[model samples]
Target: MNFNQKELVKSTVPILKTNGTDLTKYFYRRMFKDHPELKNIFNMSNQASGKQQHALAGAVLAYAEHIENPEVLINVLKSIGNKHVSLNISPEQYDIVGFHLISSIKEVLGDTATDDLIEAWTQAYNELAQIMISIEEGLYQSNLKKSGGWKGWRAFIIADIVEESSEVKSFYLKPKDQDLIGDYLPGQYLSVKLFVPELGHEQVRQYSLSSAFNPEYYRISVKKEQNNSNSPDGIVSNLLHGKDKGDEIWVSAPSGVFHTSFATDHPLVLISGGIGITPLLSMLETNKNSLQENPTVWVHSCRNEKVHAFKEHINVLNKDSQWLTTHVFYETLSEKENTSVKEGRIDLSELKDEVLIDNAKYYICGPEVFIKVQYNSLINLGVAQEDILYEEFGPQLLHFN
Candidate 1:
């Protein structure tokens, strides 16, 4: 962008900081109203809860803050790109988003939104959208070139289902065309696009692969999101729960940056709260199957054994593994459950220093607050920020200190 454009964009940083939320909330309302068809692709549940608005607000604020040096935000771009790829986001869709976004800004800013300022954001939006488009194109190409990969959404048949817990179940999905699927990195997620009869829309949702990479099939364990006070009930997850074996569902190729398959000699520490264990379980199984000498520890927190998915599976994996050990915390024990389990939230301090190797890399997943608390706790325990990693369930609300 030209100097005048960059200056104008930078000048809006303060305004963004103060009115980001209100602006994005308005943006979504305007976009959905003008383009209600997008409701099929966007998560209405998140939209209703204001989660997507919050995410867009943070993204815009960050963009305005670093408009002159967006290269510093490349990592953020990659994360967003990964998600876009999972949802089969096409480059053309950016035009729709950009148009609505620009309109939203003008509508929200009212008299203060000068033509030049609006023009600056228009250029800024296009530039950022191009970068995302390029990244997503590369991702799509890589996925298609893989042995068992296809672009966009592919039909998959549910071959089997395994009930993991009272709340979670694992669905084994195989390609209907009998094509090969690429070997995805552990901790990555696949987006499932299913037609929800109730919503009368095809909804897309990402579920972490719960098993090791398989060429013929993918295993995804889904937790039925029970509706309560904090949030609206899950639309897609509940739809998935009702799906029967042999039914077909459309799924995008795997995409994510939170995997641990990259070369790292450091010990591995996998921490999870509640159903966040899905992807971490894949990483654990991948590492174990690789037969590497890396020491691995699984620390999980859940309501209790009844709701704890993978309890038996984990025990079976732990039976003879010399390098693997598990520490579990249950909020309460069941009548028939054993007593060695501790009560309350996850307390990493309880583990010995040896278990948490000084140079061990930590991969944490869970709810937003749970992951944030664990991240800070790990930092306080002397774990370097670089050594700590997290997988957010949605647009990141937490900031690193």
Candidate 2:
């Protein structure tokens, strides 16, 4: 971009910081009004909760803040690219989004929407879109090139459903054609698309592949997202829970920026809160036989034993390994429990020696608040920023300094 355009974008940073959410909300409303069919790809549930709006708002603000040195946003781009690839987002849609986004800027800012400012934002959005498109294109190509991978979506039959906990069920999916499935990174997730009867449209949601990467089958543990005080009933999850063994669902190739390569020699610290343990469980399972050189620790927090998903599986694995220490924190007591149980939220202070040590890789996932607490705790304990990684299921608003 030219100097004039860069200066124009810089001038709008303060406005975006203050009203980004409102602008994004308008953008979604206008875009949806014109392109209602897009609802099939976007999560309308997240839209209703304003989560999608807030997420885009945060992204725009971040982009505006780092417009001068866009390289700083590489991590952000990779994360979003993984998500886009999983959703099978098309490059043509970028034009649709850019149109409505700039329109929203004009409508929201009213008198302040000068032609110069609009032109600057248009150029900026185009550049950012290209960056995202390039990253997503590469991800799509890589996923398709894998041994058992394919582009778009493929049908998978639900071979079995294991009742993991009161709220979580593990669905074992095998390719409908009985062909080999792709080998995904341990911490990755798959975008599962289901036709919702009530919503009258197909809905897509990403579920972490709950078990270690297996070419024959993929397992995803889904917590029935019931209507809580904070949110409405989850459309796809409820539908999935009601499905029978022979039901077929469409699943995309596995894609996610968060994964355990076991590449680093750091002592692995896997922390999770509630249902967030799904992806980490896969990482743990994959690493159990291989983590001989690097000592590993699994820390989990949930409400109680009843909601705990994989006690038996974890216990079995724990008994088999000398280097793995498993700790479970339950907020309340249960009728029966294991010796590894504790009664409180996760506290890493006591385990400082294990977690705060140099080269310790920390992977955390959970509710927004829980993940944030764990992330800040690790940072506060003096862990290097790059050493800690966390994943959020919904729109990610969290960032580290």
Candidate 3:
């Protein structure tokens, strides 16, 4: 905890980086061996994907590198906290993770990881973990402090349900506890947990706040994930498929940092693909009343019109607001079916033409591949790197260059 001790741990960061991957591998092995119950919490498919492992290694090394200045890691820590919260991981679970992580480092580093080094890392992990715990606790308290928002997964009665598409449905939820619901910034997401009888324990998934922040209710649009019978059915989506208007579902407070604040009056451009339209829609709806004269453009891509969610609401907004513009691109629509709309994925040419301003603030949310392609195109098309913001759906990964 002292300066010298902190420096020692910071110096050991490079040594750990050399063994970071191995340490994470050892840590997971030990963790899963000790607590097999956690196997369900993490995405085993992602584990097989290898990219998640590399991302975790990079994150751990970065934390160890910045151990002395914990403030420098606040953003990273907050993201991790949100992910953990969505997974229903608790503070006690963190203790288990920290133990395995620290032990793995000690075991891998051998003599270089002296008792002093161990003590320093122990103190550092405790401090970092506590910061994460406190941050999450604050979020939990804030959620529960409101009239409608309460602690721990409370039931929200589905007041209204509208079919957005053949596969997706929009559910307007009202807290069963009170008439008032907590207000949230545009572009935030809520974690919904369901106790699926088939999946055994409760499974959690984050759905973006499709509806604008309103005092009376909250809304989320869910696309039911269907696949071949050979594959396992999606736990949460399938459960939502059978639910009716009167059914109750567990909900968490809106939590995400990818929100639009009243920071600037710069022209706004939002780009999305498929179901990624949820958060961006919230942002657009929230800013509908802005007095600023800046124009807002939304460019969203989907397979076709049948699968598009919230088309009617967006159409109504388009009719009412001249400053708001929306361009929908479908990958598989006949010219006769949709002659006015462009037909293809988002690319540099479309973005250059549709995005009115070259230097406007940009917000992106979509599949990883789509994000990567569009991000590169944006930078290549004269968009400033700093002005571009993105929110990945799950398990944090650095944005592609």
Judging by lDDT against the true structure, name the best candidate.
2
lDDT on C-alpha atoms for all candidate structures: 0.87, 0.89, 0.78
Encode model 1's per-residue lDDT on 1-401: one tens digit a residue: 89999999999898888888899988888888888888878887777878889888998888888888988888888888999898878888899999999999999899999999999999999999988899899999999888877788999999999999999999999999987877899899999998878888878888999888877699999999878987666888888899999999998888998888833477899999989999999988888788784788888999988899999889888887888888889988776777767778886766756455867889999999889888888888788898888988877676673
Error of 3 at 372 (Å): 1.6
lDDT of 2 at 247: 95
Model 3 residue 145 lDDT?
81
Better of 1 and 2 by lDDT: 2
Tell me the deviation in Å of residue 222 in model 2: 0.5
Give residue 159's lDDT in candidate 1 (0 to 100): 98
- Residue 94 shift from truth in candidate 3, angstroms: 3.4
Q: Per lDDT, what order, best first? A: 2, 1, 3
lDDT of 1: 0.87
After superposing candidate 1, which stretches have Cα over 4 Å from the reference?
229-232, 262-264, 352-355
After superposition of all CA atoms, the RMSD between model 3 and the true structure is 3.3
**lDDT tens digits, residue span 244-350, model 2:** 99999999999998898744356889999989999998888878645443677889989998899998898898898887888889999765766568888888887
What lDDT is reached at residue 176 by model 2?
95
In model 3, the worst 10-residue window by lDDT is 43-52
Cα lDDT of model 3 overall? 0.78
